[model samples]
Target: MTRFSANLGFLWTDRPLPDAIRAAKAAGFDAVECHWPYDTPASEVKRALVETGLPMLGLNTVRGDVGAGQMGLSALPGRRDDAVSAIEQAVSYADETGTKAVHVMAGISEGAEAEAIFIENLSVACDLAMRRRLTILIEPLNAFDAPGYFLRCTQQAKSLIEHVNAPNLKLMFDCYHVGRTEVDVPTTLNKMMPVIGHVQFAAVPDRGPPDHGDVDYRPIFSQIAGLGWDQPLGAEYKPGGDTDASLGWMVKFR
Candidate 1:
C-alpha cells in the first residue's frame, strides 16, 4: 500500500484552500500536507482537513526572518530561545489540527562555530518536540537548492539524528534534493532508511511531477513498497502545467 500525500503547497495552486483538499482527496492521496498556514486561519485549514478526511503530514515552524536572508535558525547560537519558541507555536498549531509531524531545519551555518551551535540548538528542539508528542523531521537541503545551509548532506543528517539519540527526531528525505546531490535513489534510500521519517518527491531539474523528469520513480516507489512503509509518500512537487494534467501518470499507480 503506497499511500501518497498530495502537497497542497504545490498541487492545486489555482484552487482555494478548501478546494485543494477536496481535489487531493479525489486524486487518491491518502493524506494532504502543506507549508505553514501563515495567511490562512488554522480554523479554516482544520475545517478543510475534516471535510476531506485527510491526514496532515508536514507543517513548518516560523523562521526567525521571514525575509530573503534567513532559511531557519534551529541550530544557531543566540537563537535557541527563538527556535524553541517557534516549535512551541507550531505545537500549538499541530495540537489543534491533529498534525503530528513538524519539519525543523537548522538554518544554514555561517562557519564551523555556527554549525556546532546549530547542532546544540537542534538537540534542545528535539527534546521539546518529543515532549510535545510531535515528530521532528530534519531535512538536509543540497547546496544547489540552499547554499550555506547548515545540513547539506544525508550523512550529516544521519549523524545528527544518531548524536541526538532521540526516538522522535528523524530525517526527511526529499528525493528531489537527494537526486540532485546523489546519483542513485534506491541505493541512497537504503543507506538512510533507518533515520528517514518522512519522504517527499519531485522531478529532477524542473521539480515537477515524478514522470516529468529523468528519475525513474517506479523502482524507487517499488523499493519503499517492499519495505512496508505504510505512511504517506509526500508528492511535494511543483506542477509545471495544470496540476491535474501533470498528475495523469499517477492514475495507474493508484
Candidate 2:
C-alpha cells in the first residue's frame, strides 16, 4: 500500500493544529507532517496524535524571523548558534510528539561560507537528533517560490549530506520544487533514492493538490515504490478550497 502523509503546513489552514491532525486522520493519511508546530504546545499536538493514533512523519524547524526574510537558519553565515537552537527546539518537540524526523531549513544564504555553516549546524543537529533516534532532513526549495534559498537541487542536498557525514542526515525531496528546478523527475528520484529521508509532492507551477499538474505522480509514485521507498509520501500542497473537499485526488492512492 502507498502510505500518505498530510502536510498540515499547507492543508487545513482554517483549523487549529490539533484539529488539522484529526482532519488528516479522517481523510486517510497514514501519517502527518507540518511546517512549524512550535506555536502550538507539543502536549496539545501530542494529545491529538495519541487520540488519532497517527504518527507524525516529520516537521520543520522554525523559519527564522520570517518578517526579516529569513527562510531558514541552518545555512546563514554567523548563525551557528541560532541554527543549533532551532534544531534543539525541533528535536524536543519531535521527541515529545513521537515524530520521526526534522527538516532543518537552510535559510537564504550563498557562497562557501554559508555552506560551511550549514554543514557545521547539520553536524550538531545530527548529534542531537541521534539521541532521540530521529533523522535530520534538508530540502532544496525552488528559487521561484523561495528566492535566494541556499539549497536548490538534489545534488546540492546530497553533497551536503555527504559532507556532514552524519548517520542521521538525509534529504527531504519535494517533487513540486524538484519539478520546478529540474527536468525528468523519475531520473532525479532514482538518483536521489539513496539519500532521501522523506518525499513530499504538490502540483507543479501552482503548488496545488497533486491531481492536475505538469508532473505525473502516478508513475513517479510507482518509481518511488519500485525503489523500495516505504515511507509515507507527504501531501504538501495548497488546498485550492476546503481542505477536506480538495482530497479527491487521494482516492487513487488509498
Candidate 3:
C-alpha cells in the first residue's frame, strides 16, 4: 500500500504544529512533515511526536527574509553565512524531533555564481546532517510557482547532487512540480529514483488534492512502490478550505 505523510505546513495551518501532528495521526496519516517549524520549540514538537507515535519524515530550512522576497538562502550570492545558519538550525531541530531528513531550500537566483554557492551550502548541510545520520534533500520548484528559484529541474538537482559528492545528499522529487515542468512523471521518477531521498505531491496547476489533478497519482504511487520506495509519500497540497473537509481524497488514495 502507498502510505502518505501529511505535510503540516499546508495541511493544518490553523492550529499549532503539535496539534497538527495529532490531527494527522487521527486522520490516518502514516507520517508527518513540515516546511519551517523554527518558531515552534523542538521540545513541544518532540512531545507531540512521542504522543502520536508518528515519525516526522522531514522539514525545510528557513526561507530567509520573506519580507525581502527571499524564498531561500542557500543559492543567493553573498548569503552563504545565512544559508549555513539555516541548514544548521534545520538539522538540529530534525535531530531533536527524530526527523529523518532536511530539505535545503535554494533561494531565488541564477547563473554560475548561484550554482556554486548552492553546492557549497549543500556540502555544509550534508556534513551537519550526516552527524545526525540524517539525509539532506534538494527539491526542484516549478518555474511557474517559483520563478528564478535556483533549483528548477530534476536534471539540475541530480547534477548538483553528483557535484556535492555527499552520499547523504539526495533529491526531493515532488511529483506536482515535476509534472508541471516535465513531460512524463513516471518516466522522470523512474530515472531519478536511485537518488531520491523523498517524494511529495499535489494537484498540478491548482496545488490542491491529488484526486482532482491533471496528473493522476494512482499509477505513479504504484510505480514508486514497485521501485522499492517504502517511505511514506508526502502530501503537500493546499487544502482549499478547512483541511479536514479536504481529506476525502486520502481515503480514496489509500
For model 3, what is the alpha-carbon lDDT of residue 101?
97
Instruction: For residues 197-229, write the lDDT of model 2, one tens digit per residue.
Output: 999999998999898979988888988998998
Query: Model 2 — TM-score against the truth?
Result: 0.98
Better of 1 and 2 by TM-score: 2
Q: Model 2, residue 138: displacement in angstroms?
A: 0.1
All candidates' TM-scores? Answer: 0.92, 0.98, 0.98
Model 1 segments more than 4 A misplaced: none
Q: Compared with the true structure, what per-residue lDDT tens digits does model 1 show for residues 96-175?
A: 77776888767867666776776676666677777768788888887787888888889988987887788988899989
lDDT of 1 at 210: 85
RMSD of 3: 0.8
The TM-score obtained by model 3 is: 0.98
Name the 10 consecutive residues with the lowest summed lDDT in model 3. 212-221
Error of 3 at 16 (Å): 0.5
Which segments of model 2 are wrong by more than 4 Å? none
